[model samples]
Every structure is written in structure tokens, then in C-alpha cells.
Target: MINQVSILGNLATAPRQEVLPSGTVKVSFLLAYNSYYTDRSGQQQEKAEFFWVETFGRSAVNAGKFLVQGQQVAVAGQLSGGNIRLENGSYRNCTAIRAEQIEYLSKPQSRTADPDVEPAVANVEF
Candidate 1:
């Protein structure tokens, strides 16, 4: 079964970056999406959903530096279910996107320099 999801929205906050001892980098943020629909009474109803998004490795570091609060973004990835225990001792099932490919939705007027790194080479076998 395929469990992929694609979304276009604005970032609720800036991406948070962290590096682990294992050399893995992590980036996390929340994306807010909104929709409007007409009701039976001819009234319009608006709803918004916030999705937790995460990226790892090189992509994670890039996201942190380039993405800022209120910036629009497009993301393609999988939907995952995780849980967090609340202070009330209730478990809340968290829904999030494990980002596969992330794209900027609008033109970036300013560009930030990426951390310098050696060019990487890869080999593929057919």
C-alpha cells in the first residue's frame, strides 16, 4: 500500500536544526494548510491543519538555513503516525510528514550560502 502525501502551505515556524554525534543532522518544522468549504446553510466554513515535518542528513541542514517562518513550501512524502504523552497522561497520536522532496513555493529574493563541503560522488549499478 502506498501512504504518500503531498502538501503546499506556509511554514508556521522556522526549521529547527540539530546535529547528532553519529553525524546525522535533523531539521523539523510545522506546515499550516487551510481550506474553505460552503455549508448546507450557504455559509462558508474555514479550517486549518498543522502538519509536523522532518528531514534528515544533508537535506535537514539545508532546510534549517533556507527555510524561514511564513515561507511557502511544497513537500512530497509519507504520512506517519506517532504518539506523544501529554501532561494529562493521555496519549495523543501525532500525524506528520516524513519529507521526501521539499520545494520552495515562492521566489527567494535572498539566498543563503550553504555550509562548504566536499563534492560527493556516488556509484550506481544497473
Candidate 2:
């Protein structure tokens, strides 16, 4: 079965990065998407939806360093659903994306480093 999903959205929050005990890296972030529709009364309506996205390994490292809140990003990944327990002890189904590839659609100008300085890529390990 095919389980791939792609989304282009703005970052709702900053990316959080962590390294596990096994030395694996992880990054998590929230993405916001907007939908526009025409109502029956001929009025335009807009709705926003948020999704959780996770990346691992080298992708996680890049995401952590380059992504920030309000930046536009394009992500291709697999969607999965899980059950979350609420504070009232009720179970709720939640969906998230396990990002396999990510692209920066829009980013702040300051995010770029000085052209005179070379990026250190030799030290980065996958």
C-alpha cells in the first residue's frame, strides 16, 4: 500500500533537536497549512491546519540548523496515526508525518551565512 504524503506549509514552531543514547539524532517541528474555500453564501473562508513533522539522522541536523518558526517548507514523508491519552484520561487519535525529505520554500535572509566563510561539511557524519 502507498502511504506517502507531501505538504507545503509554514513552520508553526521552532524545530527541536535531540540526540538519543544510541547516538541517533531527531528533530521535531509543527507545520501549519492554510486552506481557502468559497462558502455557499459566496463568502470566502480560510482555515488553518497543523501537523507534526519529525526527521532523523543528517536530515534532522540540517532541519535543526536551518528551520525556524514562520519559515515556509515543503516536506515529503509518510503519514502515521497514533493514540494519545488526554489529561481527562480519554484517548485521541493523532496523525504525524515522518519526513523523508524536506525543502526550504521561504527563509529569512539572515539565515544565510557570509559568502566569504566556507561551510564546514567534512565534520558532519550521517
Candidate 3:
């Protein structure tokens, strides 16, 4: 079976970054999308969905450096999930997207004067 997913949404939260014990960089954020439908009464209705997304390596670094809350992005990846043991000695199942690629759909409103900071590029894939 093929396992792939592609979504376009706005970032619901700022990307959070962490360094693993093995020295790999990890970044995670929430993506939100809206669905519009017409009800039986002919009234328009909208529903929002949020999903957790994870990125690693260069993509993680770029996401941490450039992505901000409410930024639009497109992600292509696969679904990943596992059970985690909580501090309360209970196990909980979690699901997330393991991003293989991320495309920035919107550019930042402003740029820093720091020359070290790279300029934001449209449709950048990482």
C-alpha cells in the first residue's frame, strides 16, 4: 500500500525545535485547514482541522528559522504515529505527519537587517 499525504494549510503555531540525543534537529508545528460545506438548510458551514507536523534535518532548521504562526505552507509527507508512555504511567497514542518536503507559500512581512539571515524566497522547498 502507498502511504503519502499532501496538505496546504496555515501554521497554527510557531515551529518548535529540539535537538535529539543523537544530535539530530527536530521541528514540530500545528497546521490548520478549513472545510466549507452547504448544510441541508442551504446554509454555508465551515469546519477547521488541525494536524501536528514534524520535520527533521535541513527542513527542520529552515522551518525553525523562517516559518511563523499563521504562515501558509504546503507539506508532502507520510502519516506517522506511535504510543507514548506518559509520566502518569499511562500510554497515549499520537499521530503526526513526518514531513518529507515543505513548501513555503507565503513570505514574511518584514526582513531583518542582519546580513547573516537569508532572505525569504517564495515557493521554497525544504
For each predicted model, how many residue pairs clash, with residues at least 3 apart or on different chains?
A: 0, 0, 0
lDDT of 1 at 18: 84
- As a whole number from 0 to 100, the lDDT of residue 3 in candidate 1 is 94
Higher-scoring candidate on TM-score, 2 or 3? 2
Angstrom error at residue 36, model 2: 1.0
Candidate 1: residue pairs that collide: none
Q: Any runs in candidate 1 off by more than 4 Å, and if so which? A: 83-92, 107-126
Question: How high is the CA lDDT of each candidate model?
Answer: 0.74, 0.78, 0.78
Residue 116, model 2: lDDT of 59
Poorly placed runs, candidate 3 (over 4 Å) = 82-95, 108-126
lDDT of 1 by residue, 53-102 (tens): 88888778779878876678999999997653445666655578989889
State the lDDT at 74 in candidate 2: 96
* Cα lDDT of model 3 by residue, 65-121, tens digit: 999977889999999874434456675565679999999998544445455654322
- RMSD after CA superposition, every candidate: 12.3, 9.8, 9.0
**What is the Cα-based TM-score of model 1?**
0.74
Quote each prediction's TM-score: 0.74, 0.75, 0.74
